[model samples]
Target: MKSGIFCLSLDTELMWGRPDLPIWRQRAATVRPNIQKLLKLFTKYNFPATWAIVGQLFLPGDPLWHGPDIIKAIRKTPRQEIGCHTFNHLDFGRCPIQEADEDLKKWLQATQKQEIKPGSFAFPFNHVGHLKLLAKHGFKAYRGPAGHWFAPLGKAGEIIDSLAQITPPAGKPKQANHGLFNFSESQFYVSAWGLRKYIPLSSRVGKAKKGIRRAIAEKRLFHLWFHPINLSDQTGPLLAGLEEIIKFAKQQPGLEINNMEEMTRQLN
Candidate 1:
């Protein structure tokens, strides 16, 4: 049961310059349109997705709060799963553990009104400092960069051929790229995407096509993840490429598109 998961990260840009950030914070200008675009693409292609909503969106006093609207947006797409990025997209490895836990608590609280109970968590910057805390807190799974889902590999893009090549960081489990459960294709950690301006549509489609083809033949998982903000200024071509890839995906029988949470459950 291989799955092609599209996770649209909804990180609100509440940058350091709080005073100047609001100019970019116009919900109608930023979050709303990108999200709407995602819904349209997902619906147009009949793909299921996971939305990792920022937790601060539910903060009561913030005037630009999009908690209600974000939820409404997710409802527009079928098989959309809700997950948490953080109260803000603060890197958890540098953030105080207490603060991180508080954000998770606040995120859970924000979801009390919704039908979804998020079982998966994605770290901002793909940094993790406390898996014990997350597990102790009842989080079912933590999805870090496949770059080193089996951590201590000298950041992503570093070459460590297989699990045997690198020593596990003290106690972290060794990863198996060429293994029985998953294939090396899904094991690739994204080095960077959205690199060039109006990049050719074939470039992106090729990645999806390659992943999908390999998944069909090898029975592997084609996991593609990206931030919505990556498309902030140059979303036109990205969306078009995504629409094409997704449309192509739905046409393939047994080519399922599901959320990370669903994949986690099935894999585990």
Candidate 2:
């Protein structure tokens, strides 16, 4: 059997993702530092990650919103793939097709300035749509919605799954419209903020380990994703738990870690 693929993707959006939220505004300062820490952790574990950055953040000016420097850092890092999280963080599900197309065009325009033609896309809020536009723009793969049956139930289901420590489902990538692959998410590394702080770190690590084992057994993909800002609250424990998950994954036989780009190539 082929080895299982372990893919980690970070939605590297800062305030762009939650500009309407007061808490996000308050926590804005911590995003950069937490991202730096995450980069170091990935380096320590020799793990490659896909960073799906918000395209608007790549524009010039506005230190609080723009992040050209962060983009440069990810590009300079070895084995890291820089992907797109849409321009303006537009929700494709609710937006008109033309609007979605415009956003993708804008995202391509922004990233092209940096000589980056992103092949992997992560939908804003994981609300997927407009695959034809993505493939038209040359995106080969996208991080799709979670595969869990309980996912559609939204927040309550998510909290229940986290508290129950359910083994996250691992599955094979499915080909979508216009030559794109849907790399469905296996688990979200829940953030230690608000009511989520009550969930123990052990549950997160254990669930990831379980997902890895399931992937190896099923010969499927285990794609884990999280926003960088999620780590800003209680950063220490979250980072430590992430490191533990990475270390555990490293020790597992028949499991190969990859960024989204690598996985897409293998699929092709």
Candidate 3:
């Protein structure tokens, strides 16, 4: 077992980041601060992070959508890589496999302008139908559940996640099932909000850090992920808490935090 790759999906939506389930307006303003804070800290630490930039967030001629400063921020950030989440953040699980292929291909075309063809993908809602389509569509990896997601088949690129989220509002908004996706081994999924919820997941950052540290020490890869917007919002502990996490990650010996492309290169 080794320290796994940390993959971040920077999506602009009302799905998970804004746990309040904020509508469109709030969703836009919410993620800004978290992303800003994340960028500053990542740059300071010289951590190369991968941003699964939501293609819809960069729509041409749309001021609200294109955050040039954010793009610049990512470019200025060291060791950062970019990937796609789809043009409109379309739901692949809802569409035919081939239809989803076309949608994802369109995303590839848009992202190709920046020389990114998405070696990996974080499905819009992690609602997967047919994963084989990913390998068919030129995606070398699919950042999804290791196995239980499909039952009977789970492999690489199908990363594992264990969210373990606590302190809920009222209902389990489809995204709130933070428990591990019923998988054994090192395969588990965690989300952006998990960054904050880790307070509930572990006794203290040190204990949690030890687990993450141990995974790395054992040479087992442990991926910690979340959306940039999830970190950007003005909501909770994101802004201030980010520095602490980065500083902690840097202090751990043998633990190297890398962007997605680097992770794929190292693992795949």
Q: Pick the candidate with the highest TM-score.
A: 2
What C-alpha lDDT does candidate 1 achieve relative to the native structure? 0.55
Candidate 3 local lDDT, 1-268, one digit each (tens): 2443333334443232233454544555655566666777677878666566666544454444555456656766777766656556667778877777777777777666767566656667656555666666666544454334424433321222223321111111111122112111222222234233543323323333544555555554444455555443333454444456567777777666665466557643
Model 2 RMSD in angstroms: 1.3
Give stretches of model 2 more than 4 Å off.
Answer: none
Clashes of 1: 0
Q: How accurate is candidate 2 locally (lDDT)?
A: 0.87
Task: Give the range of the ten consecutive residues with the poorest summed lDDT in model 3.
Answer: 167-176
What does candidate 2's lDDT look like per residue over 106-138, in tens digits? Answer: 998988877888699999989988888888888
For residues 1-268, what per-residue lDDT tens digits would candidate 1 score against the true structure? 4433333333343331133555445422455577788887777666776666667665444545545666666776787777766666657888788877887777777776675575666677667656666665556655555544445645332333221232211111122322112211132222223334333545555655666665566554565565565555556766776777677777877666666566656666
Candidate 3 clash total? 26
How high is each candidate's TM-score? 0.71, 0.96, 0.68
Model 1 regions lying over 4 Å from their true place: 1-28, 60-67, 148-195
Q: Which stretches of candidate 3 lie over 4 Å from their true place?
A: 1-9, 12-22, 61-69, 146-210, 232-236
| Distance from true location, Cα of 106 in model 2, Å | 1.0
* Candidate 1 colliding pairs: none
Ranking by TM-score: 2, 1, 3
Following a full C-alpha superposition, what root-mean-square deviation does model 3 have from the true structure?
8.9
Which residue window of length 10 is worst by lDDT in model 1? Answer: 166-175
lDDT of 3: 0.50
Score each candidate by Cα lDDT.
0.55, 0.87, 0.50
